[model samples]
Target: MQDYRNESEQFDRIVSIGMFEHVGHKNYREYMNVANRCLKDDGLFLLHTIGKT
Candidate 1:
C-alpha cells in the first residue's frame, strides 16, 4: 500500500477498505493526501472503516 501513492499515475476509483483505522487520528490528513494524489480529478473515493464501538 505504501507503494501506491508514490506512483505518477492516477486511478479512476480508489477504495480503502479497513485501513483507515490503522493510521492515527493526527495522520488522517496525510493519509487522505496520499489517496488524493492517487485519485484522478473526476475519480471516486470510498473509505470504509468501522467506528469506535
Candidate 2:
C-alpha cells in the first residue's frame, strides 16, 4: 500500500473528469492514489464532476 502511494507521484499531469462518479465511497482513497501518482510536482491537475440527477 505504501509502495503504491509512493509511486503515484511520478506523473507529470493528471485528470479526473467524470471519474469521481464511478469511484465508490469505499474506494475513494484508492482512486485518489491514481491522481496523486500521476501528477508531477509542478504538473497541472483538473477535475470535472457532474451531479447525478
Candidate 3:
C-alpha cells in the first residue's frame, strides 16, 4: 500500500473486501490512509470483513 501513497493516479472507487482483516490492527490507520490518498474526494470506499461472533 505504501506504493500508492502520494500518487497522482487516483481512483473513483476502491473495493477492499476481505482484505482489511489481513492488514492487522496495528496498520489499520496507515492502510486506510493509503487508500484515502488513492481515492478522489467524492470517491467511494467499500470495505468488508468477517467478524468474530
Can you give the TM-score per candidate against the true fold? Answer: 0.79, 0.61, 0.78
**Superior by TM-score: candidate 1 or candidate 3:** 1
Question: Stretches of candidate 2 above 4 Å error?
Answer: 1-10
Error of 1 at 29 (Å): 0.5
lDDT order of candidates, best first? Answer: 1, 3, 2
Candidate 3 on 2-29: residue-level lDDT in tens? 4434566689999888978887889889
The candidate maximizing lDDT is 1
lDDT of 3: 0.82
What digit string (tens of lDDT, one per residue) describes model 1 on residues 2-35? 5543666689998989888888688799889988
lDDT (0 to 1) per candidate: 0.84, 0.69, 0.82
Name the better of 1 and 2 by lDDT. Answer: 1
Clashes per candidate (backbone, < 3 Å) = 0, 3, 0
Instruction: Give model 1's clash tally.
Output: 0
